[model samples]
Target: MRLRSLEGRLTLLLALAALTGALVYIGVTEWPLPQAFAWMQEAMGRHASVFQPSRVDIFVICALVLLPLCWWLGHIVMDPVKRLLRALESAVASYRDGDFSISIALNRRDELGDLIHMHNELGQTLREQRQNLAQRELLLDTVVQNTPVALVLTDAGDRVAYANIAARHLFNEGRTLNGLHFATLIADAPEALRKAIEGTEDALFSVEMDGSEETFHLSQRAFRLQGRPHRLQLFRRMTRELSRQEVAAWKRVIRVVSHELNNSLAPISSLAHSGAELARRGDVQRLPGVFATIGERARHLHGFIDGYARFAKLPAPRIAAIEWKPFLDALALHCRFQLQGNAPSQPGWFDPVQIEQVLINLIKNAHESGSAPEGVTLGLNVVGHELRIEVADRGPGMSEAVLAQALLPFYSTKRSGTGLGLALAREISEAHGGRIALANREDGGLRVTLVLPQSATAS
Candidate 1:
């Protein structure tokens, strides 16, 4: 029924041919004689009694008049149809060649107008769909390439399907990661990943990887693809985060340690000079006790100085393969002195020796901040590869002024406090590539936390 199709065109052509043949036959066989008879009848009925025209003359005249009229009528009717057919044919050819811009103009209020309208609608729809697809593709490309963090997409089988430039460089050293396995790219991915893919549980993990001597935190998450069982992994590096914390801890240590050393050494020097003056004055009865007191104070001064020196001269780590369980156990045993009196319960997964020192200093500070029976509580935990060691005190928490200067060397709230202990503890943790921070606990206490690297093993 559609006039735009090839079959319709053939039908129109056949109808036009049949009409032309009929017109030709009528003109040749019946038109001339009828015209001649009409002319003779007009003459006889008006002016002449009898009138006859020769057949040859009559035929010639009739043909001269009739042929031109018939041709004019055919031209008027068929010319427009022929032009319309040519336009339609051209449109069809262009459409077949995948060009949708061609439009046929049909001014008549007829079936041809309807055909043109339908064609225009189809072309516009195609153009819109194409434009929409192009825009979506461009957006997707821009987001993937320009984002700062690495992005990797894998199929259900854990085969790499797509990876952004950042991800490719991180895993494959600038090479493409089109067909590698997810397990192969990461050095010994945890079993959590496999469980995530299998839909057993959600996998969210934060791990520390060995980067030279420094540790880098990598946070990972797994998500399922839309309308599919496939999983996707996302990773982000947290090295800068840890670095910022370490720097803050270092500032605290330097401020506290400097204040403590100045306080003790300055007074010790004056006391020694005073004892020498007493001996010169011949105060024999008081001289022995004064000299002995001077010796005792000097020895105490030496011990404080030695502690500060050790704190300042923390050595770089000589890394080796270490079993975590055994390492923590040994570290705890070394902290027995600190844990002896009114210590908090044992914390989880801490390098006991380092943590013990930190706790001893915090406990000592807490004891000095208040009277007896108001000691501190220490807590440690390993939550998702992050070591959180907290030293909380039941005594009054630090004031704004004290908290502000808490990490500075030799800065203490007490008159007799050396202040080197906390500074030393912070420095030791930092040397192990970790951090220490102090804050007021929510339930009215001072809370100090030391965050350290979990492990540096290859897996």
Candidate 2:
């Protein structure tokens, strides 16, 4: 082995010890034995009874010198090893305590040196990883704290575990919300807000706060955190978004109305001019046809105006218990549809007249959707606490782009479509505290669903 290595050093020490013993033996037995014995006899002459010298005295003397010499040599060889072991032990303890900054700086030209180098690299890697993790956590905290949405995280015990800055400001007036019971935190909240938070479903509710009404959309999720159940609630302010949408809706309405009026009136004006020119030329027979054409356009324009007026002036629904069989029978008179199944035996709560109108408009749309007349179908059923009225057609379904804006007023696919049919249905459904959903069927069709609460009243 190389002399600088640990194994080499131990071998060198053993060789040196053996050599020293050999030299001591040669000097005592061969070079100075007779002289040493004469000196020892003179010094022991005064204590002759206690000092009985023998031929083996040289061996005892050699042992006395060699034992201390061997001990000193062993200490010289093991001191570095002992110190390195101490350093390694300390560094491992520090690592166990989550302190990766501790590193052994001892250098050796052996296996211990390689161990130290590997240990330092591990520490460096751990330190870098910890730093990156801490930075990511800080960035995430910054975003959560500054977001406009209020966020609350509660533990399995229903106690608040985390609340962001917005959540604190919203619920506790800038006070910390950690460790508070979730129910107690919302105890003083508005009835609508309390009900929305306590319920298992997501909801949108308005609260009168600081003399103005603020609307919020509440969403909740349940998940496992560290193998324990937790719930997260997010409240997003939607008042400004809703206000912007309302303004844009009014602008679209005005634009659509102007375009429609010009389309109808321009042709009517040109026809009138033609009729007057013919009169000047003494064309009396053509005058009646011109007037008849003008009447038809006028009637179409009147009907166009009346549809918008009715949509804008829709009354609140007058809810009443009505049987599905009679209502469906009455709706069949206005629009032909194949009822998919037997009507519910249970009576539904809704305004029969308004619902009948909604079904008629839907069935009419299905009939005009390029489907065979027999392919248009209507379905009614009660699901949970809601009543679902579905109108489906086996026609080519709409594209993603069209489906997104289909429920908006003045959005239509047809050349003569007023676009108020689906929009009016949506408005009526919402007025009864319900909603409408549009989906595409798997077999190539569109499904329009009007969902109303079975026990809902006008809202």
Candidate 2 displacement at residue 426 in angstroms: 1.6
lDDT of 1: 0.63
CA deviation > 4 Å runs, candidate 1: 1-148, 151-156, 173-179, 183-215, 223-255, 275-293, 302-459
Across 45-107, the per-residue lDDT of candidate 1 in tens digits comes to 866654444667656755676566667666755676788889878877887887767776676
> What tens-digit string does per-residue lDDT give for candidate 2 at 288-362?
998898898899889999999999999999999997777777887898999889777678999888988998999
Worst 10 residues of 2 by lDDT: 46-55
Best by TM-score: 2
Best-performing candidate as measured by lDDT: 2
Alpha-carbon lDDT, every model? 0.63, 0.89
- Measured over all alpha carbons after superposition, the RMSD of each candidate to the real structure, in angstroms, is 15.9, 9.3
TM-score of each prediction: 0.38, 0.60
